[model samples]
Target: MQLTNKAGTPVQWQDYLKSGHRIFIGSNAAVPNALIDNLIENSAQLHDIETVHILTFSDNVWAKPEHKDLFKVNTLFIGGKNVREAVAEGRADYTPCFISEIPTLFKQNILPLDAALVMVSPPDEYGYCSLGVSVDVVASAVKSAKVVIAQVNPHMPCTNGHSFIHVNQIHAWLTAEQRLPEIPDQQIDPVSERIGQYAAMLVENGATIQIGIGKIPSAVLKYLMNHKDLGVHSEMISDGIIDLMKSGVINNRRKTFHKGKTVTTFCIGTQRLYDFVDKNQHVEFYPSEHVNSPVNIAKNDNMVSINSAIEVDLTGQVVSDSIGHQFYSGIGGQVDFVRGAWLSKGGKPVIVLPSTTKDGCISRIVPHITEGGGVVTSRGHVGYVVTEFGIANLIGKSIRERALELIRIAHPKFRDDLLQQVRKHYWVPTYQDNTPTSVPELGAVELKKFTLGGERFILRPLSPADERRLQEFFYSHTKETLMMRYNHHLTQMTRENSCQLVSVDQHKDLALCFTQRDHLGEIIQAVGRYYFIEASNSAEVAFVIRETQRSKGMATTLLLQMIKIAKKRKLSSLIACVRRDNAAMLKVFENAGFVRGYSEDFDEISLCLTLEETITNAKEIE
Candidate 1:
């Protein structure tokens, strides 16, 4: 790698990044540690430096815990190590995104940068330094940065690869002999190996591939050596790909974008693979923005991206790095590849996971996500979901159908419970002719309960084992449902309970009640929602519920239950609201001794149940 100034003039040791310049560091393991060291070393002299890095590894030593006043690492995704401190200690912040669109953040100047720090191998006779192992959007960083510092390393493999900066392309150089951080060998489990086989089966000869790192990704690569011309335009590559390369599988000659070039951004593996990627012209490694960008990635048709997950709901909500509320990993490139592959002609972005956990106690698929679970790829963005059982093409499906499909593929022991959960959470009637309505296209992944001789079926709380069926449910219904759940708001949903169990023992002014779901096996479309039935002074009362599971009678039942419980916790009159067209709902309030009120707004009707009136009604009935 060589250095040059912005005006095409070479600088020996110029500080291109001055005050007020926004800087973009490579995301993940591709982050330039040398550049970060330089920034840390020079931080005392710099002010208001906005640093950007996506899903970076343990490099936060430079985003010093004590240096918050000087540097700000504004991130789009929250990786595991930095998440805890970021949410609580307020260090590195979280940005919600699918991996597919990160490059847009840079190209669109959503977060502008003043400079870019890139790491590369020494330029070859052709006068171009290879970006080495990683290619994800770093090219966008290099393209947008006001200044560029090329850090040339000798130990880095000069493999002919993707990342590139022609000798005339860069602005400055900080030559140093540095070691690439080592990532231990990724070991795959037998189940993951099966999933890898399934994922690899989807890849055809002459297909261009994009893959992230991890057991599932590496395992998929392990099974791909026998395939032919399996070109790669990926963000990162590990040792698994080396075997494929040596076997003459990843030739990249037929690739439409970087023809005859295996493109990538960063790589991690044993030195054997590292040596394979060094300054190799056949391999062109660049920045993530270029490699991961939907535009750049879309250039290669038949791009197949294989990613993994912590959990995938039946409705296609992918929770790859988290368990409900806790942050585990960042959304790296799941969405990027999913979307890129979706947009590419004949492309497929696949999320591969095992059918069950180690204990077989929990299914990885689910009808819905856990509480506080982040929906990374809203159903629309997902295409295929694979497990050892089979593949489910969830695109354009109803959540109901998606849930059904997910259930069929779930671990046999856990499928029924997951299906029960789907019914409860989705509020859907039993499937007819095996055509469920959980898919988003027919309707959004909603509670699909329609009248069955005046009785309605309702889905309750969803578990992880119901993902496929939920995905099919989205496909089963009309797109109207998707827009309602993900796009449009079908009803007003907000958690109204001040007396939540979470608020218990806070010793605050509110009376917090302990809500219990001792029965995780309870069947409903969702945990309909808890109502904080509140009774104010002068015999006034009201109730509120959360948004995910509205119109499912939790509020009405909770209100009636509250009236009894409050009679035990002691209260008088109870009041509630029922949208006029909500006939079944008005009956719930009326049946609970509430008197319907004539309001100017029929859409929002009021109901009142006086204790005196209720006692009189009980006496009359007696």
Candidate 2:
């Protein structure tokens, strides 16, 4: 068959073919396999022919040893399973570039393409063809390549937005029918489910979110099913988003930028997902230059970017693209969205991974990154790291604090060794506690959110990693409050002293704090704790509230929670010593059924609540 250009002149495929030509291929599921197979069939006519592309789901026959002499393969993103061995074996080349900047490489002739092989939807009535599900960098390749060969497929979804290419631009075309490649869904494991639960908690209602592919991302989407008005501005979307969109959870109505539209560069999922976006007006596809641009992403308020990592060092450096010197995957849009989310208003850049590898023999959290491993997300760019163990907020943390926070969320079996390593490195003081505490069940230690004075706050158990936060809380307290709470004019609370307060065994002695989050990080607004008195068959309780946060009934709330905990422990009684002048605290205790008693210290009065009697009275009242 003879193909013709817009000028109506018959075009021959051999006329554009040359021995040393560099060719660009469409990325992901949009690869034009028919054109590629034809090129391979004519390999005898070509030598030193370089082929460039990003990730592709099709069989990478060009990278095979038999075709190595004829075609030199170079990939922008190293994610194809069949091509990874070739790149690792040094037979194929991997170029590291951000998805957002890939277009510039083509536009400026940096990677200079002689021809582009692409698959597109059949031309519409206006003679314009849509780039379908993979418009990311293919749009630039089509415009910059000298010779454009297209495999027009009827199965390609004719998506909306900046995905159209006029048929006149094509030098030649051939009709083909093929199913787009699909990414099979993997089952969500327990570890991934836990990480997802924690990551989902960081997302708020009516917020924009960017998530990538994999078990952890799917788990996050699973837990977000109940969220309202969620928006998506991601580089790609998978089948995980279909249920959320159908349930009206991801309406994109509250998005600050590109409101009412789900923005993406490409997609790779099942036929169901393709059918969902085929003629869907709510879904819009744009070039990676615009979709992954940090400035464009930051335009949306409350942007939450959740990405996975291969390994993370204690100091917050993330290794994603490679494990040591071996290239695993290409530098995709992780940094782009992370920086974008960091710049957005009320944004959260979250990294979620399992605490250990699949075998559970190696910890993903390490004292340092594996030698030669590239740091894709620098320590400064990292905000939150989540594992099945827990979430660690590392923004604005010191090296010592970062170490402690990361160690706390690491696998328990490796915590002591990690602590020793950090101690040797002087990341933590020598006197820092080395005993690893048992991880609490999620149901028992889940964070409780409450609002006071029109501001939100969280109440949860104090962790050993909270030593610095506890110190900050001490410094935030007024001198009068210190005297009233501790009965001493304490001038300073050293790290050593703060460590003792935060590292107690919760089963024996309980410590809890109320924290309010701001631009700086979580700030402690109130602290309530009780020391178990075994001999007395009771517990000694105390409370302190930040001066600015006082008189808002925080003390009452703390006291009530403490009472509930005490009741659960089945203690005989609860005790406290309050200064006579502290009428507010005295009322809080009294309202909770604490009876005042004479005290030897003239300035202080003793208070006690007998649990047995209180429960009986409450039951009678009920």
Candidate 3:
């Protein structure tokens, strides 16, 4: 409950927690093991213990699946590290927030903390040492932790930045020489290297770089060796950053936060990098909220955010998490950093990916997304998208141009098919399918499921535009129905015109009877009213909203009541020239026990039903 330091060399604490407030320790490679060991010794005395971190690789006691009775995790960004698994397994928890906001949340008492376990270098003669180059977000916590416990070590670097606080600020100090963990650098592909170049090209000098974990990001960093005074403020870093820092390319000179020092949420690089950060005041690690906040990232000058995606549609919708319906990864800091980069002065938000998948059967650049594909980055947020083939700047392109531009950058093998997909979706009339061969053009309405409602009322075209639907509907009708309801002799009518009979309410008494909810607790069981422009109550279809349209059952709710009025009035037996293929409407009348009869005057078929029969069908569903 107090921020007072222990006031002794190699300070120590006998009681870490004295109240409901839990001390939050940074996890991942930056975990303060000295403090953690002390915590274990006193773990039995603690209640409602909570710790927040992206991931950790220690004894795993803090968030072990078996110890849910004690520790809890409030993770920021997910990593392959232990803490992430503990959360997904339910031993811990996932609290989503941008990395940049963690420090504020800590300071504003949004996530109140009673203490903090930090690691740092031993103080110099002047009682000062660096928080190291990784000053990304830990500085905020250092300023706010009620009890600042530092793990002072000589191996830790003394890099310049706002990371260092005087020994007087720390309540307890746990001296140790434990080093930060290292994440190795793997090889990069030629195409990934090219894409990295393009992504890096957009980055101006003195820009803050936020890159994720991958060969692409590493490759992009490779191109920036010649760029001067680039700053680093990101979630994690590998060997790629070590060379830059040693080369004077990353001096952290232009950064707004932790100026003159490297800033990072955590580090996972090589043994060399690990040895370099051991008590080396140059490296610092903090929670993701401080590192990934949009506001925090925007503080740097000329911020450049480079992120990767699975696929990007012509409209610039970036899908980075899924293959289709499967969940590949969670929505992480791409959006956070992208927004931050966009808001920074002279910032550039870029999405970099290969033009096609590994197999090359499918193009990474599509005209539109697959069914149920999630849009991780919206069209408006996208600035630059680059693939091996070319760079697409969809920032201001029209929908049509976007599609063509994406297709142009698509692998040659799949470009034609994607263009055809464009024609099918947007319904751009007179669309050319880019390919020489004629591919049957499909409509934009993706995968239509046969809703039970389709049986009751047809989407009969109201005009020539409806002819296509009529042709499709009638083609599925029975021969007997074709001859009875529609034939060459009848008007060359389509489904659109067939539903144009009349209003169901021809009688005054029965007009309002069926509008009420049926026995099934549904209101649209039947409707009766004057239907067509002619008010032809003489013929009516006693329609019901089918089961398929249950929640969205807007159709039958109106038709059911309409049928009641038509039956109440002795209106010409309620004529109907339904297509023989119209099964839904047929079910309505058939279930109601209404029989079909041919019209001699119009040479068309119709149905006649009594008031009793209309009530019977409406009641059956109820």
lDDT of 3 by residue, 1-622 (tens): 1223455543224455653456766545556776777665655655556776544545555666655655666655445545656655666565555455667788898877777776677788888755653444466767777777776755665654345678778777766777665567768887787787667656667888888767888888898898898998877676788788899998888888778766676566667766665554555555557678788888987887888998998788998766685434445678888888778877778898988887766778877777767787889888778876545555555676567556655665776677678787673234233321110111111111122434422121021111232344434444444453434334344433422321112222222112121111112222223332236435544232323243434334334444543444445444445556556655555555567887664544467665444552232220
Alpha-carbon lDDT of model 2: 0.86
**Candidate 3 RMSD computed on C-alpha atoms after optimal superposition onto the true structure:** 22.5
- What digit string (tens of lDDT, one per residue) describes model 1 on residues 1-622? 2344546465433356555567776655556777667656656567667777666655565466666666676766665354446644666666766555666777788877678877777878898776665556666777777677767777656645445678677777666777776676578877777677667767777889887677778778877877899899887777777778778898887788888877876777777777776545576666555677787788898888777788888788888756788666667767777778878876787888888887887788977788877877668877778876555666665776577667655665676577677677653344321221121211111122232223333322232323332333334433444342233333322122211211221111111111211101112232222233444622333333333345545545445434543444345555655565656556767777888787776557778776645532111000
**418 Cα displacement, candidate 1 (Å):** 1.0
Per residue, candidate 2 scores C-alpha lDDT tens digits across 1-622 of: 3345566576665667688888998988899988778677755667888899988888888888888888888999997766898999999999999999999998999999999999999999999999999999999899899999898889999999899998888988877888999886789988888888888878888989999888899989998998899999999998999999989999999999999999998999889989999979999999999999999999999999999999999999999989888889978999999999999999999998899989999999999999889998999999999998777899889998899889878998998899888787888876687533642421422566677777777777787789988998999988889999989899999989998888877777778788976533888889998999999879998999999998877877777777777777788899999999999999989988899998999999999999866632221100
Clashes of 3: 63
* Whole-structure CA lDDT of model 3: 0.59
Q: TM-score-based ranking, best first? A: 2, 1, 3
lDDT of 3 at 46: 57
Each prediction's RMSD to truth: 19.3, 3.5, 22.5
Q: How close is candidate 3 to the true structure, as a TM-score?
A: 0.58
Error of 3 at 224 (Å): 3.6
Q: Return the lDDT, model 2, position 116.
A: 93
- The lDDT of each candidate is 0.61, 0.86, 0.59
What is the alpha-carbon lDDT of model 1 when measured against the actual structure?
0.61
